[model samples]
Target: MTAIATVTHVDLATVQDGGRRGLAGIGVPISGAWHRSRYLVATNLVRGAEDPRQPAVELLAGSMELHFHLPTTVAVVGPAQVTVDGLPFGAGVGLAVTADVRVVVDHRGPGPVYLAIAGWEAPLVLGSAATDTFSGIAGTSLRSGVALTGVAGSGCSAGAFLRQGDDAGGPLRVVPCEDVPLPVGPWRVQSTARSGTRMVGGAASSSGSRPSRPVVVGAIQAAPSGELIILGPDGGLTGGYPIVGVVCSADLPRVSELEPGEEISLQPMDVPAAMQAFAVAERERRVVHPGVLGRDGSRRGSVPDDVAPAK
Candidate 1:
């Protein structure tokens, strides 16, 4: 068993995995990683098993400082800049971090940065170890001075992996749904406290003939406030917002990389192109896990995304 001490000033991290599934029909939100792509990438980088046992730390935003008590592997998946003991460390590759070295994350990218340990050690809730703020399931957010336990292992081979769909520039490719007016052009991200999902600008809203419940992840829906909200992994399974369009499944991971107030564009992508995109992400996923992670409720609470970049 190994314990990594949290040496920070706030509760900004949580243990997440394939969220607790099959329980959503009972009124539970299917909470999981906001971006499944990065979750798979980071977890697999550390050779983390997709089973219920091994869970990873999902950093929603800001900086994190940790002191490892044992030697093992860990990795950050996303656009985050990582360093150990003040030396630059790779973000998407597994690295062996030894005891007492400080691992720091400069999370300036769009999505949450995942920190995967070599093995599982967290206790389970509803058959999952994910921290769900909406459900009050987590004993506490990963706060300063708390020690984390895990079984250390020599993670995966040393190599770096790249994010998919970067060549298309900054736009998030999307496909419009029938009977819905797709919001076009650049949208600014607003501060929303809900776990997993971030609210987009108030471009279009309607009292359309859509139910205010049973929304799925990635469903772009019109909020009653005339604002459109994009659901993430831990997104509400049911909401009253009318479904307008969906961000192509492959682009969901890229959505996580988005930064606050960062201008984002959603380009129309057809079915064939969408599937091809999904395949690209899926291929990167296969490099680590034999199967996909669970997708129940692994929701993240509103962690501050307002951290200024390190000087």
Candidate 2:
């Protein structure tokens, strides 16, 4: 068996994956990767698919570094420069490594970077490997000098959709709304927490704490002050805030990537339109880089067994 890498320095990082599902009725937060699509795509890039339950290192808005301990490939998600052995590398791409190689994360870029190994073998709890920051379910946030292990395997590969560039299109599209006022222009990210990303300059027609109510991943609740707070990966199973509108599943990636102080917008959309957008996004991602997860959310092939260190 081959050892993967050892964590040298970490800045507010944790292990995260697809997230827990189905326990919301009993009140369990769906603590997963902030950007689900990015996580899935990144994992699939390195492993040809995402296990959904496979854990990956989730880095926040700070610096983190590691030392590659074996021969394998890895992926780095989001906008951050990856330096291998003192050389600058691309973001949203994979890199090859051997024993004793140094990999550093230049967190100066717009972040929430995800670091995933080839054969993810992190410990799982409640059917997920994602770290529940709110409840500390699977495990606590990662600290410096810890060694993260992955299943040893043979071979190395690259992803098809390893394209370089950012997609700065129009405002993100959201589902149709009722009495809730349109977030007219760019709204700034006032702050981010495990529960949600609070936006400034929006008004909530009605606001007040109520009994904890069931909430899904992208529920956008409005405060009496009109400020909008979109649920994060660690969103509570029940919330007391009044939900004004819901963000479409297709735009969840960009929504989760919202950094504090950054400005963005949301446009109105319908159910059918939203579904179509999601379908299109999936197809595009696969077309660029074929993956293991399909429409039914099943893997194309059997998952490889985790290998132990060579005897």
Instruction: Estimate TM-scores for all models.
Output: 0.79, 0.84
Give the per-residue lDDT digits (tens) of candidate 2, residues 1-311.
Answer: 34577888888778888888877766677788887766776777677666576577878768788887777777777767788888776556555567788888765545467777886577778788878887776664577767777676542464334322335456767774556665645678898876788888644465576787777777887777878888877876676777766888888877766678888787878899999988877765531333323323343444323211110
Provide the lowest-lDDT 10-residue window in model 1: 290-299
Off by over 4 Å in 1: 1-11, 48-53, 154-157, 164-170, 192-205, 270-272, 284-311
Evaluated at residue 261, the lDDT of candidate 2 is: 86
After superposing candidate 2, which stretches have Cα over 4 Å from the reference?
A: 1-3, 160-166, 177-186, 207-212, 287-311
Summarize candidate 1's per-residue lDDT along 240-299 as a digit string, tens digits: 666777888888766666666767776778889999988876764533322111112121
Q: What is candidate 1's TM-score against the reference? A: 0.79
